[model samples]
Structures are given as structure tokens and as C-alpha cells.
Target: MNTRQSRLDVLHSLRERETRSGYGWALSTDVPPGLQQSLQTAAAQGLVELADREIRAELSAHEGRPVLWAARLSPQGHDVLTYLDASPDPTPNCTPPSADEQVIELRPAQMDALRVYANLGPVLRVAPADGLVERVRTAYFDRPGNRWRMTLTTEQIDSVAYAFYLRALSGSVAEANWFARKYGVTYRVDPATGRPGAVRPRARTVSP
Candidate 1:
């Protein structure tokens, strides 16, 4: 059996015995060393606690050695088992954004706003303007030859919108909208449900 299955069996065994605050497993003399090692790992991951054997029968007959031989689920381990036993929800239907869907040209301040917002999610805060500019420069614009690319690509815009979406979803809409309006951008509203959708840049006015 795979290591995962073996570990799972160990956990189930503990459950079957309703192992509480005492020496848990008294393995047979034939149990493999690999499964014993697996138990050690499970203990390390906060899944189970292994205790030294309390009885002579719990010691390995062949090795004539005391076994580190008891198991009980930790609080985290119990939570994992509970989640695994629960009914799972169906997968949601979702479509990825197209390559050039609603591309927006960013002004300098708008770009900084996006950079700061993306750096911290749902925090309702921004770094200093200069600091944000330095970060954006270091991350995307700065080149090996000390050159910089001023224009933002569709991919960059998509990333900004996605980050904004996460922030808005986390209940920071008011703060997000304030920044959006300040930067001449708006969080897209879903026409069907009239909820905030994606972040989009405003069209530049052509002054005659």
C-alpha cells in the first residue's frame, strides 16, 4: 500500500479504538519499519501524537526494544478528519478572461495605486507614492540595461483587475471604489445582478 494509505489506516485504527489520552497502538511484531516511520511523520505534522510504550507487550519482540508506540489525534488532526467526512460542494462554473478583454492604459498615479493595492490585499491602505513607484519600477519596468518600459500590457491590466477583485470580495469595496474613482477607473458592475464586477479604466476624454 502507498504511504498515504498506510498513514490513513493508522489514523483509522486510532479512531476505531477511540484512542484518548493513553498509549494508543500496540503494534504486532510483524509490522513494517516504514509504517512506523510514517507514524513519526504524521506526529510531526500535528496530526497525531506518538508516545513511548507503556506496557511490555507494546515493545517489538524481534528488536527487543521499546517502541515509540502510541497514537492519538491532535486537534488539527480531528479537524482534518471532520472536513474529509463532510459532503463537498460542486465546482463553480467560471471562464478565464480573454487576452485583451477591456485593456486599459494606466496613468502614472493609476499605476502606482494599482501597484500598492496589489502589494497588499484587502488592507485598505497604500504605500507612499514614491515607494510604490520604486516597487513597480523594480518589479516590471527596470531592465538589465537600466532601461524602463512605461506602457502596461493587457496581462498587467488583467493582474491588477484580478487583485482588485480579491480585495473587493474580501469586503473592502468602499476603499477600493475610492481609489478607483481617484485614478479615473471604476470597478465594473455586473449588469445582471448590479454588483461590482471587474476593475476597468475609464476612457480618456477627447477635448476638442
Candidate 2:
């Protein structure tokens, strides 16, 4: 299972336990010993939060070092886990839509449409052609309005296009849009409003 899934299982296990439960032993017993380390890492990453201060103290006492055990999910972590749980798997092993299918080259207008769709959520997949696999990527929701955004260098355009082609092969239009919005390097004008369209990074521009 993926890291998020493993962390989710750990969180569920923790939630099932009674309050005041010990941390170290509970973690070793509940999750695989190998995964215990991952759990700790997850905690450090703020993906999971411990319930009580006493548990941290106990862990520290046992380890004879200062230990921090607040595994509560941060808002971003929660969003990631929630998205992972909800999104359909878009790996390459999944069957493609069809053989002998033509690759869809995204137009500037289509790319803009994709950006509008992707700003709504964090997880998106895109497929653009046959003989290619789905490309899956995560987006960070920007502050304030929570706009989904991703940065890619111009050289990465082919990689991004491959991803979009894969999503298109999977017949996931929404996922395709997300991939386009996150990676498309072209722009288009809105015919109705006559406003500046989604910003497309130039191939010569390098993301810092």
C-alpha cells in the first residue's frame, strides 16, 4: 500500500484504541515493526497526530530522549489523505481506452479549460494517447481561495504531455484537465470576457 494508505490505517488503529494508550508499544504492535518507523516519520511530517501529551512524555521517558508524539493530521495532510482515499487509481496497469487511438494535442483554449477544472481539487490524472500510461500528480491548494497549482520547467512539457495522454487513454476527462492545468505550457484568451487566460510558462523559463 502507499504511504498515505498506511498512514490512514495507522490513524484508524489509533482512533480505535482507548484514551491514554501508550505510544511506542501501541505503534509497534498495531502497525508492522517496519511500518512503525514510517509511522514515526509520518508523525514527524505532521500527517498524524498523537492524542495525549502523556503519551509523548512516556515515549520520551522510554527512549531517554525528548520525544514529540502529536500525530494529529494537519489541514494539508488531511486534504492529501482525503484525496488519496477518494481518487480512483490511475496507474499504468489499468487498461487503456483503445489501441490505435490518436494522441490529443491540447490547444491553448483546451488548456485554459483544463486549468479552470483543476483549480477545484488536489488530485488529478490525465491521459492523452494510446501506448502511454496515465500520469498522476498532486496539486497544492494555494492560500486564500485554495487555487490548485503546480510548477514545471519547459523541458518537462513532453513529460507532462505524456501524462495527459495517459489520463486521456484512461478516459478520465476530469483527470486529463487536471494534468493539463498543472502542466500545460500554453495559453488561450477567453472569448466571452476578453480577459487574460491561464498563465502558461514559456519553454525558456525555468521554475525556481
Candidate 3:
């Protein structure tokens, strides 16, 4: 199995537990000592949170050895998992978006229409035939680059996804709908004009 895939699986299992039972999910349930040992590694990497008692006990026993994980994922871990959920195994092909909280994939039509968006002439410099998807996976994640990709966080998507949608609308309804479906962008019908316009992002965060 892939290295990160196992860890992601382990973490996903933990997340499922958290999803089902909140944070009180038991960490001592795994039968294999190796699996338990893997937990320490996850904790040491800060992907999961472990109790102080476990930490103290492990340190005293191993004295700088690999730490075992038994807790749920941290906020950063959760965000990372969402941002990195791409195809063909657990290998993440996209770089984490810069200074942001999400990364949304862009459809081809939106990519075309977004080029004509207002004042973007000086923004997107490299209109690669593939639209920087390869480069984004391996290199840059600047504001313009991310926006050009439509790979944005919730706030950025809320504001920019709409403009691109409108721009696409002028080109093709199919393209506009494709973009809207990607982010589930919603509209409020204007009271007087009764036209569906503007954009609203579905809540991606919730308070516990």
C-alpha cells in the first residue's frame, strides 16, 4: 500500500468515528500493536490529537522513539484531507492553495470564460493549454493562479465563482451551470425583477 494512503486511511477511520460519536471515540480498540504504533506516528506528525496521559506514558517507555496516535484529527489535518482529496489513490496531485482554506477544481468552460473577467488582463499571465493544472500540482498557488484555476477557498469561491459564472453565462449556459454545480452556488431571486442572481456558498464549517 502507498505510505500516505495507509495514514490517510487510518485518519479517515478516526474521522468516521468522530463523525459517528464525536471526540469520545475510543483509541484503544485497534487489535494490532502495529496499528496502535501507527497511531503514535500520526500524533507525532500532528495529524491527530492524543491525550496527555498517553503522551507521558509513551515518552517514558520509549524515550524519543516513535509516538503512537490514538486521538482525532486536528483542524489543520481535517482541512488538509479535504483539500487533498484527488483521484487515483491517496497521492495528492494539487498543492495546498496559498493563504486559504479550500481548493476547488475548475471546469474547462469556466476556465475559458474566467479569462475574460473584468480587470483580469494583468492578472493571469500564463494561459497554458492545460490551464496550469500540472503546474499547480507541483509548483505555484498564488492568488491569481488559484483564482484562474477556480481552485479557491469558500470565501474566494463565493465572490469570484459568481463573476466567472456570469462571464461564462454570456458564453454558454452549460458552462455556467457546470461552474455552479461544482461549488453548488445558489441564487436569490430579485424581488422586483424576479431574476435569479448573485451567489451564495454552502456552509463548509460548523460549530461543535
Candidate 4:
């Protein structure tokens, strides 16, 4: 069977015997001997963890173990369960872009603001102007490069807005305005009386 089928089979077995046994399956049997291998695969994939490795058998723990048995969630296991539980649904209508989408280049000042907001580590060295934005854009799009790029989500933006008034603060208004314009988001402020005008760019359409 394929990996998906094997995983489903293993999960099914675990779900079935969850309440009846000594911390799930003790060992695999003729009824389904490949369960051990499936568990190992799940452990490798982060869905489970090797809770214990005794001379007799290896034990695996799932998410419920933490809540039901007061077990601790290992960092790796926690990341895996979070991914599995919160993964976005895939739909036929959603498709990845075939070619690079046109991206607005970040100005030097804007790049500095992004770095500050995103808490990027010390700038190693600035790239030349000609290829800087393209490189930055690629880093922004790549999940593994999240450390360097401004990966602010909508919710995070809202939180930041509540925490501080960027426009009212010294030396921050321009950068704040630039970011607000780029994302087409407006901070909560009096439209008629605010120092920084509430005007923002039209929201850009994005593809999945």
C-alpha cells in the first residue's frame, strides 16, 4: 500500500484500540503487522514520537497523550501535530502561480523598516540596488527564509497597531505609512484629524 493508505490504516488501528490497551499497541500481530513500521514512519514525519525505547519494545505517543496522560509534548512532536491539525485545506480552485508574479521593489528605507518590524538579525551586507528587491522578494516568498523577510500576517499587524501609534512616534511615521500603503491596511485613527492621512493604496489581489 501507498504511504497515505498505510498511515490511514495505522491511525485507524490506533483510534480503535485507544481505550482498550496498555498505551495503544504493545506490538504488531497478524491482524496488522505493519503497524510498527507505520508508527515509525509517523514518528519520522513528526506526527508521533518515540516516547520510550525499552529492551522489549519502542513506544510512541500521540497528541492525546499530553492531555489524557499529562505527558509532555516534545518540541518536534508539537510542531508536527500543529502542522497536521492546522494545515490549510486544498481545493481544486486554488493553484500555485506558474511564473513569478510582479513584485514591488522595496526602497532602502523601506527595507530598513521591514527589517526592524520583522526583527531580522544584523544585516550582513546590503546587496546592490539592481538585484536587491528580487533577492528580498524571493526570501519573502520562501518559508525557510522567514527569519530574514517581513512575514507579518494580518493578525500580527493588528496587534502591532494596538501596541503602538507609529504615526505619532518620532522617526517612525514615514516607515509606518509606507508599510500601511503597501499592505493597504489603515490604522485606527481619526480620518479628519489624524496627522498621517488615512489614505492607503487599493488592496492588491494575490493568488494562492
Write the residue-wise lDDT of candidate 1 on 2-34 in tens digits: 977676776665565434323344343333566
- Tens digits of per-residue lDDT for model 2, 104-195: 33444344444443442245453222212222133333345434333333423444444444445556566446545654532334455576
- Computed on alpha carbons, the lDDT of every model, listed in order, comes to 0.51, 0.46, 0.54, 0.42
Against the hidden reference, what TM-scores do the models get? 0.30, 0.32, 0.35, 0.33
Q: What is the lDDT of candidate 2?
A: 0.46
Q: Could you give candidate 3's per-residue lDDT for residues 1-208 as a string of tens digits? A: 9998898887777777656643344245432566557767887888877657665465436434443434667777787678777422323436556775456555444554543553353455522223333333332223444433334545445444555555554655665576567657643454656875555554688778
- State model 4's lDDT: 0.42
Give the top-scoring candidate (lDDT). 3
Superposing all C-alpha atoms, what RMSD in Å does each candidate have to the true structure?
13.6, 15.4, 17.1, 13.7
What local lDDT score does residue 207 receive in model 3, on the 0 to 100 scale?
A: 75
Lowest summed lDDT over 10 consecutive residues: which window, candidate 2?
A: 127-136
- Model 3 alpha-carbon miss at residue 131, Å: 17
- What digit string (tens of lDDT, one per residue) describes model 4 on residues 1-208? 9977566555555545443444543333322445656666766766554444441232323323222111122356455445655543322112332343223334555555543434422342421223333333334322343233322334444433322234236446765555556655555555666654334345689999
Which regions in candidate 4 have their CA more than 4 angstroms from the true location? Answer: 1-16, 19-23, 26-31, 40-79, 90-179, 188-191, 194-208
How many residue pairs in model 1 have overlapping backbones?
A: 0
lDDT-sorted candidate list, best first: 3, 1, 2, 4
The whole-model C-alpha lDDT of candidate 1 against the native structure comes to 0.51
Order the candidate numbers by TM-score, best to worst: 3, 4, 2, 1
Q: What lDDT score is found at residue 20 in candidate 4?
A: 48
Off by over 4 Å in 2: 1-29, 54-74, 92-103, 107-112, 115-208
